[model samples]
Target: MVPGPVSNDRLGASNGRSSPKPRILVPEKVSPDGLALLASDFDVDSRPGGLSPQELIDLIPSYHGLIVRSETKVTAAVLAAGTSLRVVARAGVGVDNIDVEAATAQGIIVVNSPAGNIVAAAEHTVALLLATARNIGRADRTFKDGKWERGKLVGVEVGRKTLGIIGLGKVGMKVARMAVGLGMKVLAVDPYASADVARQASVELVPGLADLLPVVDFLTIHTPLLASTLDLLGEAEFQRMKKTARVLNVARGGVYNEAALLKALDEGWIAGAGLDVFTKEPPEEGSVAAQLARHEKVVSTPHLGASTVEAQENVSLDVCSQVLLILRGGLPTAAVNAPLILPEEYRKLQPFVKLIEKMGGLYTQHYVGARGGMVGGRKFELVYQGELAGINNTRPLFAALVKGLVSSISDSGGRDVNIVNAALIAREKGIVINEVHTRENSGSTYASLVTLRSYDTDPAAAGKEERGAEQIIEGYVSGKTVYISKLDRFTASFTPEGTLLILHNYDEPGKIGGVGMVLGRRGVNIEWMQVASLEKGDQGDKGLELSKVDSAVAGMEAHGSNTKGRGNEALMILGVGGVVGKEVLQDLTGEEGILDVSLIRL
Candidate 1:
């Protein structure tokens, strides 16, 4: 049975002090033991049966921390209200419920218990695969119905079947190992992964989706939801699968096209399906997910992959420990979307970090310019300060930074991009990568500054540069905007979509309006625009300062409330044009305008 709510009055109690037990509130179901432990050290409060958005909005302001599961929506509103909230813990692996951007912007650390659910999700996948193959659930129902039709239920043998796995991540790898032990031949396809690694897992790696689609008797999907994977298994791809093949998805919703899948099931495009997730949850009573559950050929469950006793206990313990640590003024190990800088150090550089990261996002988008292929790969570097050694999971942030940089260029196509293969890919494409790490205890207990560089060859252009790779793009996230610190060198920025119009021209009158007018005339809608400039030798524009650009940009106090029409141009990102192979820099700068345009990648 599900748990009940905790007393809200007890939750409201706080020791009269400027610094109380950094109150952590668990609004989702957590293990009793974990809660007891937290109550001993923290002014803990917890409840079950997920919080409605408004209730969460109302309660958020009262706590220093919050915890939840997939059912809760950690929207921007919750983040805005929780001014006192220092940390948020998701008692499960996936953080799809949390608005990571909102949390990060507000300096709230978001943690997830990923390791806790791995074993359970993997084991559940195996159980479903076996159940689907043998029709165990169907056989039991039939037998209870007084129909002994053993002859009609002749099950397929797994010993000789080729099990095709779409993703080779933690769950996929576990499935492959178990399938192989059961005498099934395993073939996997993962473009971003190494074939050598798959072979090491004792599975054969096939080329792309086209090759694996028609040959397998069973297919399983395990991947994240991003631009590329959105609606991945659509109508055209469904037609490629053999009619006898069965498919399974236990990873994320929308990874499969539900409409296409239903048609496939009805049209016999595929034999059957085994699903643990859907585009929507517990699905409406007569929805496709529910309808599919009623079909004899399909096997279903209400996302039971992480429902095991062990997984729940693990998640509860993991989140409990994380909340405790953060309340004690230490950063969490499983924070889902917190930026690389430490909390204390981050406070110091908060203003600049936002500017730098935003700039880096835009700068990256400018050079790579909406192109899909790998640009002359760029090198990544990070300088670490005190206590980084304790945080073993910092690697994901590094990859996220690279992905953020790449996303600025090719929003949809650059997602699979990661730090593991980023340098290698850069090297293969003749891009150089350099890394630097520094440990110091002077500034803050824990702090870091990152720098990303790229060769001169533009990601939007087909041409190569004379310099091996010009330092075309760079930026980092640190502290508050007005008082940001010089955490890194060079101001790099990138946008997430379409050609960017980067203007570094003289910051004179009418530059922003001129640029906007030029782009508008060229049929480009200004999606989002940020302008930054330094008053000669001011606090901003200092050499080697990530915060300098943001200080300069945010410092320009608008003349009045009506400040939309004009400003000096420091940088501009446009969602101009759709997906294309070429850059459109010439159009914005060529027209009679004050801004000099540099067409960067989407």
Candidate 2:
């Protein structure tokens, strides 16, 4: 498989001064890491402050990618002018500022870094929840003003309290877990979350907001600002809460109506409110949002939910990674508007989409084409394990995998691949699809795992399953990152992102140096490398899987069937940054003790 047009057109064209690379427009301040990544492969125009709608419309036509934060508004008019745009990405989770409907109609992908900032947002929610219960913010302000009215400022206890939550997403689940640890009994209302998911978090699921409101001592919200959720909490909802109850919001603005919240405070419907977001940021002096923030009973902060350094870095990398993947003819899982899937299911499967597609891309590039086209396999094997295997419809996952396969093999940028047609394309090409579902075990190392291997038959007979490559790659998602847990028999911590160079060599001195010398001469920088050799099998890298010397001895005694278990074999998986031509790989293979090399891009 060859690098698709995204690399050859956007990336390879970028290698010289004659042809311009894909251009990305950044309208607001984003992480420097993201900026650097975009700048390396594309022409970047960064303004940080923002662009007016007219300025954006005027400038969007020539750009291929656009990266924004919450401030930049991607209007329909602006999108209409973005004739060349391939993607519009938000550096954080929300895409409210981006005209998603317009982007979808134009066949442009809309993506956001949803996984990156959940922890930061969840922690901030807890901070506000506690600050409101204990009157910590008002206490700090009054104490700073030289008043110490401890009796009047006395607060309530949260332990053993009944906590109510709206929206059981990643952030909500985390908040629920934290509340449970603090001895709170949690009840939640979310249409998307399964009862099993909530039960695992030790939360009791309720039917709706109505069912949840009346019994809460503290109510917290963590939902998006959509039509249904807009003004989700109003006077009527507030009236149902306990007179001493408190509420907090750190998710998005306007989910709790501003005027209604003020009335709740004024009427003493609820004890206090904690807010980290406003319908309008920096609300005018006399506006409802401003009044809510200034009220003596309200504990407010500027929208700082995703403000930590770690969150900034994570979001930057996550968004940039998707943009790069899409530009390079790959399907990105973090898309807000993908074709032919229900909105809710897309949301649930986004991260796993990235994981499965990457597995397919990796398998096709290194195993399929490298081993020769259409081997003995009757179909590609996909195995699902853990809680996610219960998904009723997995066609989207299959389509995503096939799209990755074509993206790795074709040069058309995979622009035609969509959830509806990827499976159809595979059938037309004589490639069969197979799947197996299994449950997660507590004794297993990973909570969820997706395995990709080749399933084969004699072709003449066609009834029985046989091993094709027998090389399996199992992918795992932890927190916000996707990694390869097991690549064949070796346990691994290999994050299959960007460009990777996998080298198989003999366990001998200078083998590593030989490959390094070739790459160095070619100006290809090795950003990271994972090594596995028989001599130091006890430990190699911090998280990478390594082959052992003892295993090699056992393998040799067992007649040397396993190549990795041979007494003098080693592996080097390198994360390379910068362009490497076929010449570099040819030169690498010519080096002594180097048996093979595979360069996989996703």
Candidate 3:
């Protein structure tokens, strides 16, 4: 029975903040009992059914948690619109309906109830296996029409049959166990499963599909629809299987190549198939799936692998509890994309964590243009030096850097991107991270320092220097305080905070006054300013892996030969009181010798 909603306060955060309850949006129908659990402590809006794509996008902007079923398509657009969304929960095992890559990119945790519907789906697969092998659907149709066709409705015996299971996961394992109990010999092809585990289940492990396909009397695919599993069983595979072998697919759509399966059915490559899913749901009119469903030798169900009432109830409750945990700043039992970090480790890494993100933001806003960014597919290479290099894990710091990079470019909440999912999000955006650690410090004022270098995907032409990689932001964390000491070719000293206006220009007269004039007219105050290149030389630049000479040469080539050296150019780091608008920025840029102007908030 479904439980009723209860009143409660907000969840207690790991950071010790008693923030208001997280709002959960169930765009698709889930069990009321599961919703009741969410309602007890958090706010839940269980919509009657799935909404249109646009409807979900429009409604997701303010939601922190989104619970969905198979019906809801959590596309990239919908995830982007969810500015405050922290987690997305699927009430079933497969999250193919959710844009997991997009969700991860925005640092949103994606969780699913892997165990809830396992038994039901496993049972359904067996049912379809029996039904198709015996032509039960055709017999039922003929019998319902008041026709007797006893001689034509011949069936095969399940006992002593050879069954090949493609995946040995929860549902697949359950199906294998059931098949073994029926006196069937089972062969599995899962690299993750060991020989001991398969032996425990009374199943034999095959080296590959080639070894299993030719021998089995029945082939059942239970793998998820991933890049590797997409079109896993096709024409070639079908031809290799036994002529009388039947097929079963209760896993996901597109797992078996639809066109190949249809051709196999028509050409008698295999006896028949039992399909519960299609590449396109509802099997559109005149579509391949539609034709496959109507085949005489095939048994079809409307993707009812988990349609039982018990399955629905179990999934809903399981998914809700997972959502509840994430909303309360806790990790779920089955998170698809979330960083696993101990609380002690997180605390130990906290100081550097905050510093790294600021460095990412600073690098983007301050040095990207100056370095003539030649990014290699939005790549960032981090070189951790000195004491910090000895730490076991550096994922949290890297994730923080990604969070900073993303937030610097958009109005999206920085909090939306965190250590939990930032790395996954970065990958979806084609962002690459290469990290190097050096326990020995070559020579530096600070005992520990981190350098974040950014570059795009495409490599530069022959003999051309990748300027983006040459440009880096160097920073350090002292206790809990973070400070940026270097930017590109400039020796900058500032605490990353508020909004900063970076001005690049030749070391000509009136450059500072020109910026002051624009700000003065616009009523934006210049609280403080630090001018680099005016100093004689940088002792800190010595012994660093990245030399400053290359940048000097690049800058000279970019400018004219008339500029002598460091004194010829200057980078002014200005602490601004207010945001400089487009007009004001243009005004500043129009000033003589003002090479570039960028405003970034940190």
Candidate 4:
């Protein structure tokens, strides 16, 4: 059937057609309610099933817009088929499978229903948790198998269990509230969330994982799988968890280490695990996920958390609304990956990105050493992923995140900066700036992750290869201290305020005990400690090379204000029986094994 043509001006200014209603194609099944609304004003077609990628490639060129669910793979090839397409709408949050870059480059707006299924997803996580804890699915299977042995299917109750939620945003907070309603004690671990917010949700909020591990009975993970969060729950972390504790992971796979988890479950280090995601998809029979599914103690599901009928309808409605808005030239509101500052602000921020890239260059020049030549010339590559993808001024936002990160490293002691001058200055110093953007909604904030990479030299200097070297630096803006997230090779470490301890030790047994003993004697407390070996992952680089520790130690030094009196103060205190003096603090902060001290004030 030939769809009706659009009006003259509505055909798009470039096409120069007369008054026309935009033609839309729902290539996949959408909410009937949403379709009813779209049909009122749009030339709507709902052919949503059994279409091959080739069929979609053949059909999309005729429509002005396309809407779809997970059944479609909107790859670059598929996008190329949409010659007249003005918008692509995803009826759900994640756009990972879509070729967003291709659409954006074609000036086609992409829209998603980010808010519609949030509560649904959150509730699903809770359901999965309860099911996992109480052996609900196992019990159902047993009953279906002609078994009436209820006594053998004993399970735990949600009531009175301490639930640890990793991310305290919408999904995490909703789960927290629901868990509270079920009489579970909810504890949240989110650095971004204020304590008052958790309290308002009737949950206790802890600042870090160290504080959360020993207390919870059931641990439910909701944090996104970012560089910092990948393998977040690993062998070391699982080892710290209480032996009686059970784990539930309904968020993204890879956020937890599947191998480590297998070890944990197999060794009985943990009571059991409930997983809806795995590092691998559609795992083979007898795979760890499959084995877990067969295990009486463990519970597993096929990623059904976001598959409810209500969730489907809500997401369709939400996506349809956003599609209409985008077709009318409006930006998306539920964009999950990047936050778009106003155009005026974006224009104001572009130059700063160049400035920041240059500052990254500066850090590379000094700490990155000879191999740091990758950032020496040409433009630095900055990837802007997330909410930034939905905006018309996405490039500018990319520039802003980069510039914001870079300006943070300079000793300029100034605030206002312009892109015009930033580029000029960067160019004068032979700096190049390039960027790429992508996005998704991971039940966290519509966030932006900007990864800065050097332009030339060896490619290995980009991610994990560049670890030990200090990739980021701290600079004073006003009087407050700010944290800059940097990647030293594969590891991401942050410097938070407190105290600094510097320790140098050989790779030997009892080093940790020795360090602890020294600190204990001087009355200095150790809140948390982490040790990284540069050669641990690179077995080829061990013993002879000290690795990134020297650079990491130096980077920590750059963040602290220089202390004045050390030895002299210690002597003075010792002269008067020496309570609370250098011996104690030095023993606490600067003992032989103490690499650094970061005192926690609160």
In the predicted model 2, the residue pairs found to clash are: none
Q: Could you say which candidate leads in lDDT?
A: 2
The residue-by-residue lDDT of candidate 1 on 170-266, one tens digit each, is 6788889989998999998764344445677789877677888889989988877654467778778888988878888888778888878888888
lDDT of each: 0.60, 0.74, 0.74, 0.56
Q: Estimate each model's TM-score.
A: 0.62, 0.54, 0.55, 0.60
Per-residue lDDT tens digits of candidate 2, residues 175-207?
999999989999997644545557877999876
Between prediction 3 and prediction 4, the one with superior lDDT is 3
Worst 10 residues of 3 by lDDT: 1-10
TM-score of 4: 0.60
Candidate 4, superposed: residue stretches over 4 Å from native: 1-19, 336-349, 353-602
The lowest-lDDT stretch of 10 consecutive residues in candidate 1 is 1-10
